[model samples]
Target chain A: MGSIHLPSHEARLACRQNRLTNTAGVAPGYLQANLLILPAQHAADFHDLCLRNPVSCPLVGKTTTPGDAHAVQPAGCIQFPDFDIRTDFPQYRIYQNGEYLESRRDLLDVWTSGHVAFLIGCSFSFEDALTTAGLQPRHQQTGTIVAMYRSNIPLLPAGIFTGGHCIVSMRPYRPEQIDRVREVTRTYLSTHGEPVAWGWEGAKQLGITEINNPDFGEPQVFEEGEVPVFWACGVTPQMAVEAAGDRIKGLVFAHEPGHMLVTDWTSNDLDKLRPGII
Target chain B: MGSIHLPSHEARLACRQNRLTNTAGVAPGYLQANLLILPAQHAADFHDLCLRNPVSCPLVGKTTTPGDAHAVQPAGCIQFPDFDIRTDFPQYRIYQNGEYLESRRDLLDVWTSGHVAFLIGCSFSFEDALTTAGLQPRHQQTGTIVAMYRSNIPLLPAGIFTGGHCIVSMRPYRPEQIDRVREVTRTYLSTHGEPVAWGWEGAKQLGITEINNPDFGEPQVFEEGEVPVFWACGVTPQMAVEAAGDRIKGLVFAHEPGHMLVTDWTSNDLDKLRPGII
Candidate 1:
């Protein structure tokens, strides 16, 4: 229950049995995904929204049919088999009519035939890749949540999903290290590839008025030579849902921010150049 | 009318005035694009299809409103001003309810209140870029059309638009030059990016039964020590339209093969590493 080296399936088993409640570093090399479930009626529109705003919502898996628990394959880079949507994650946040209701260990009670789930690529997987490449993610070393900001960039609108400004996650690095960081991250296109913005100048272009004060997550102090580097955040779709409010029909469900669904597929599987490794 | 040197706008103007019927290599540094026009009824689904199959349909610009002649700005790398959808392309292939009508020099008489235009990225611009870097595209060097084939890869389906097998354009190069070619082309994400397949082994995986006998364009005789390289072709969407058949709601229009709409933006603008160069 308290092991850090559990495999992805075992981690999900722990969550299913109520032994583990969060999945931060569990199965470190494997991929962890953000879960978003909506009523069947909104699937096509949401699918279009993901397509239009690929940087913010890089969809990894989705249900073939509404009410189906298994993730559907669509010429995916990696395949995850034998998983249930109802209880894979450590926690699930339920929203009805676009309003937050509550968070629970599982969605078994709320699960219905009308639900369609979307598994979006999470940035958490790439952080491990970055660390392995000798680039420390600022938030992890300082033991704080990564800073997140709402930028001026507008997302492409689809159906009822009138996308709002883009949400970006921030990290700090010296100017010289930015190129190496960009190269490493560029390989993982599914998980917010490369830094979208670098330094205060880049941030301002995205209309991030303040660097230290983030809209979400805890703020961190930067080193003397560090500049803020921003990547498109996976939390963007959730924020868009919240911003859409009444426009969203029926209910929506998402993974509780830090509690992602760990997959058997490794993080390296996301790299296009390196294939069949996992 | 047949000049080799002209800006993108002037080449487009020549096409507009029925003075030019071909656009290959005319605007050397500028970008050339594939055109697709459809009715508003199928716009959302077609847009979703393009978004899903970006490799095959790298959308550069789209009409803001149905039947509008002007392109909509969406933070694109290039901007084309004072362009008319009805006659900007050298030739337009009209398809009514998914059935081929005929090719025409202009669409002024056929243009109606229900059509929407989409400008897709063309591989022609990248060929020029490759030549500048001392890597010649096989077909361009031979003074023939680029070899193309239908592959087994199916595009992700959208509403009323079931995707067909991907169509890939082929070029030949020595095995050693593959890496450099990939590196140079990787910068143009909007223009089919890098090679999807290289050599006979790669082509066979895409279900191309024969290398010399291509599904479209002229067959090429490979030079000694040369391997065939494949990049996703812009013709893929047209194939999707053909595959959809009666599923397509209304009339659709496309640029005739080898004839394209030249844009004011330079080919360098497509490179993310080199920004604002246009």
Candidate 2:
């Protein structure tokens, strides 16, 4: 609290103790990721889906064993120290074989050694890149969850992770800024790179309806030449997790998108650093 | 012939007569691609090879007909105008079942109705991004081809293409520039983004040698703060074609080292663009 730039770990810790319960943004510079914890059995298919749907799920970090938390990286990357593999996130969405069960605050009710969690890359990382480049996200400026839409485009499926349409967040920009912003965000996002689609028709194809009214974030005015630029959201994976359901059983992720594990690993590491480091 | 930017017709006229026999750098704004012309019988395996070895052999365009020299594209953005596909290239390398039979100035001698030509991406498209960002390539400064080495890393093999150590082109960059260079190229290079290896032991791992020496191009200096960054060279497809030796009949690519087909598609169009335009 006294000397920190990003407070992801602090907030997660607070939430673990029931003192903090809010949507992310509490952490500033540190990367925020979507969590997808599951058992070892579905690991390969989930891994394949992330690989196939790289634009939507450009993997940040993962584990081989179901509960081997230390298997994440070359050690010393988790910011909050040795974490409990079973009960780290603030909330949990439990499903029974692809059916919605209920969203619970604690998994202590059914914790086990057979589960593994994944920390996925989020657009939050690019929010910093955008702010630094003076292309601050319009949704964040208005304090809203950026609009996400189910698109007509189909995702390349993996195993049973089927039929999840791409979910995207939009940011309006002048046509000129589109290419430059493309250069900026891509340079920072590393794994996923820049906007996969631009132009109004691409938005329309993705099921976006408004130029000014957004489905997720605070509605903002498109002054002058601003046009909507959309990127596939990390929520696609959650949809996959939900679709996989509980027959696969014991799936886990950060609770309600509020709790996230801040890691010592740089999400940009594999993207920016030489692969030899591994 | 005297104009600054030669139109498609003029460019072909000059190319047919051997007048425009150097690098096609002026036709530089859009996509430039390598050409691989083979018989229809071998197209399936070759296409499969391109699909498997996408990084080094990004298939930009291809002909569905054995001798058709046209390609269909997305909603008309840019296109290679109708020009002679046979004589458009400055040089052509003739391969008879993987053997380097001869190098010719044009394809006039072997133009056949049963040939299918493929257009592949050139690394130069990424160079535009480099210069646009004010990053100067050391090889360009020294005025030479970037030094290329055969690395010990085995390529992902496909039918007719056997796995062997990959051929790599090396560019020495200071540690800081690695991230920038990697990110910039990664945005447009498809699966070919980022450096694969960068240490002294890197060459040996790929079964390549003469650390300070090279098999092709002039030596690149690894300045005090720089480390050599290795990328899977586009010449990789050549390796596959060579390995496919005698398994099929004829094969050839356009003449001149960097000379390639300029497509009507964007390098960003990871799928649609065909082999050679015209």
Candidate 3:
């Protein structure tokens, strides 16, 4: 009631108390991570899933035991964002064993101990770096969502995680300018790095017709002269979660399409956190 | 006569014909570049001075129009390379306005058309790339003849061009990792991209120890953790032509560092390229 525009932690506390849902554009600079709250029994398998499919789920942080919200890595500035996991996210998919259950925004009633939580890295950070480098994000340029395509390229899976295809994000560029892109994205390999796929010949294998069915978002018309480059998307994990037959229950993910957790980490700082830096 | 393996081109023609002297290794991947054989008439007022300044004194294919050997891009690739000034590379430098400068392995007696030639772009094509990627020439890594030093990084002022601190290549790293060494070499901006400054930190305002100093090549130990990086030794250019105190000579610039003659070409053949694949 005071001033909805500039809400403080106190307001966030109140919101939690009232069970206000939806996290899009919340805590801008601080990370708003994808949460995978699973029973302690499935934690190890989930952890392995994260390790294998790092691009889609670079393991930022996770809890050691079930029901522990305070993971090693925090997506946001706040420690163990206190609130009911069941109902905090704008939506949640309850899967029994792996079968579709029901979607609910609040998991408070279903909240119980012995559930592990995980937070992963996303493309937002690198995208931020690109903007600073003067490479304008094409999606932002068009004021449209980056078209995401389900790729035929399969994701390497961990236990119970199977049949997950890579979700790709494409950006168009002329051949000569690719050197600049490579120069900018070179250091980012640990996060997302350079494009995983390029050229039109390989597009067909990914089920991208460049003409056929429109996928997730509007396709930018690639000029005859430019190459359509694609990067591995972070949505692969969720796709995998949907695939595995009835093992994961009470799955949690960011409901907003492009909304992602923004961490305090910077690419330069990440350079320090890497093995060589240490 | 010496137990050696000179490049086939040099062995078959220049070297065997006694028309070439000095190290042929430097010109291996590059076409044999030459200078002009010009009389003193046209070598006056800035134009003549331009030829001697290392930056612009490119390997002139011919002096006086048709007296020298012309080198190709990838060196030896072009069968009928177009060149006329006079003579081939091994050595070619003549001064009509100045003193009796007779330095030519072939025709030291004749000065055709009295036209002076300029020699430039001494680097072999993409060999820098190969080196950065760590492609070690089987013979060169040992106690070899690559020389390096700290020249006062200098500039051209009208008649004269000052030399900078540079290396003449006497360093060596493990053969196995040379590919990576080559990879980084391609990125060096000298002659092409912004060449890696010879020394680590610039000697800004003096009174500081230059990093890559104490002569050429990394810290002799270069241990397991180190990587050997390189640049187009700036001295090579500065030394190509002598600094004639009074500006009265000829001018030229061999080729851009990478010879990036942008063709009206588009390559969907990503398979043909190495680094950009993924």
Scored by TM-score, the top model is 1
Kindly give the stretch of ten consecutive residues in candidate 2 chain A with the minimal lDDT sum: A269-278
Off by over 4 Å in 3: A1-33, A70-110, A210-226, A249-256, A272-278, B1-278
A39 Cα displacement, candidate 1 (Å) = 37
Which stretches in model 1 have alpha-carbon errors above 4 Å? A1-18, A21-119, A122-278, B1-6, B74-78, B271-278
B237-265 per-residue lDDT for model 2 (tens digits): 66667777787676555444555544434
The TM-score obtained by model 3 is 0.41
Worst 10 residues of 3 chain A by lDDT: A269-278
lDDT by residue for model 1 (B182-238), tens: 777765667776677677787776788788888867787789999888888887878
Computed on C-alphas against the true complex, the DockQ of each candidate is 0.03, 0.02, 0.01
List fnat, each candidate: 0.00, 0.00, 0.00
- Docking model 1 quality class: incorrect
TM-score of each: 0.53, 0.49, 0.41
TM-score of chain A of each: 0.87, 0.78, 0.71
Pull out the clashing pairs in model 1: none
